[model samples]
Target: MNETMRPVLGVSVAIWRGGRVLLVRRGREPFKDHWSLPGGRVEWGESLQDAVRREAAEETGLSLHTPHLVDTLDMIGAGEPPASHFVIVVFTADATGEPVAGDDAAEIGWFEPEAIAALPTTPDLARIVALSQRS
Candidate 1:
């Protein structure tokens, strides 16, 4: 079977501090109003590092530095209305500035470890967060 579908590549920044991770409420389609990590599609001709920095800055008004690539995830929705699958590259980063909500995010907030379970997150996102916390 020949399939013409190509998975979209997404880059997300997992900014952690004081046992909490930054979460953003998306205000657009394909998970609209859902709280998730900060990120978006990677553009052509841009390096992965550059994509990370650009996505981070565009979504959250913060400059990321020393963003080490951590993990790659293949995400697929499980409900009756399945969502498009995406290949997400997550990076653990250290930044020197405060975060302000921007871009597709309607609002942004920090969530403690205990609060993560209550937030609406994809399975891949939950797995990545767990793996990142262990490292």
Candidate 2:
């Protein structure tokens, strides 16, 4: 079977610093050029917490800590035709550092809620960020 035929499990972090959150412009597909949270797939034998931290480090070079589960999303019908399905576990963590984009991120920046509202982003991204803040 093609890899896309299977469900993909991934982890994303809402790395918040004060009233702002970190977002990265994707360099790859599924949401290329769209601003989204910093995260990626969870490897085998890794805990959710570790996966969240590692993904943040790889994509944004930030050291995330105390990540707590916020929500899980079934994004099976997201994006354009031939869209890939992702069941992503979202976590919230606090980090402090000057983020430098790497991995699949094309660029990185910190944005307030109002700023994020104006960007092209993954479905439910704003909602996820809101939920992460409240949790």
Candidate 3:
């Protein structure tokens, strides 16, 4: 089957500190240039937990662990056969190092929840941040 014909498993981490959340500007599409959590599609043979940690490190250069579940989002395009479908798992984790954009991140910034609401972001990104705060 073609890649876009099936749902892709993906992961993201919400790193919150001092009442702010880390966000990355997406370097690629689906929602390019939009501010989003640091994550990407999971690889074969990798566990979800490992995917979370790997994605965080790859995208932000920050090592994190023991992620708490924050939310899961189904990003599906409306089409005859769906342009794309991604079931993304979200987690909350703590970090020790400053984030530097890499992988699919064009840039990085820390934003308070209120500040996040003003930026152009992926759908439900603001809501996701709110959820992370309660996790």
Candidate 3, run of 10 with poorest lDDT: 1-10
Error of 3 at 96 (Å): 1.4
lDDT of 3 by residue, 30-123 (tens): 8999999999999999998899999999999999968999889999877877778899999999987988999989999999889987899988
Candidate 1 lDDT over 57-118, as tens digits, reads 99889898778877998876665444577888998887768889999989998887677777
Model 3's lDDT to the true fold? 0.90
Residue 82 lDDT (model 2): 37
Tens digit per residue, CA lDDT, model 2, 1-135 = 354487788999988776898899999987899999998998999998999999999999888869889999977764545367889999988886779999999999989977888899988999999998843
| RMSD to native, candidate 1 | 2.4
TM per candidate comes to 0.87, 0.89, 0.93
- Please identify which of the two predictions, 2 or 3, would achieve the higher lDDT against the true structure: 3
lDDT of each: 0.81, 0.88, 0.90
Error of 3 at 12 (Å): 0.4
How does residue 52 of candidate 1 score in lDDT? 88
Ranking by TM-score: 3, 2, 1
Top of the candidates by lDDT = 3
* Candidate 2 TM-score, true structure as reference: 0.89
Q: Model 1: how far is 78 from its true place, Å?
A: 6.0
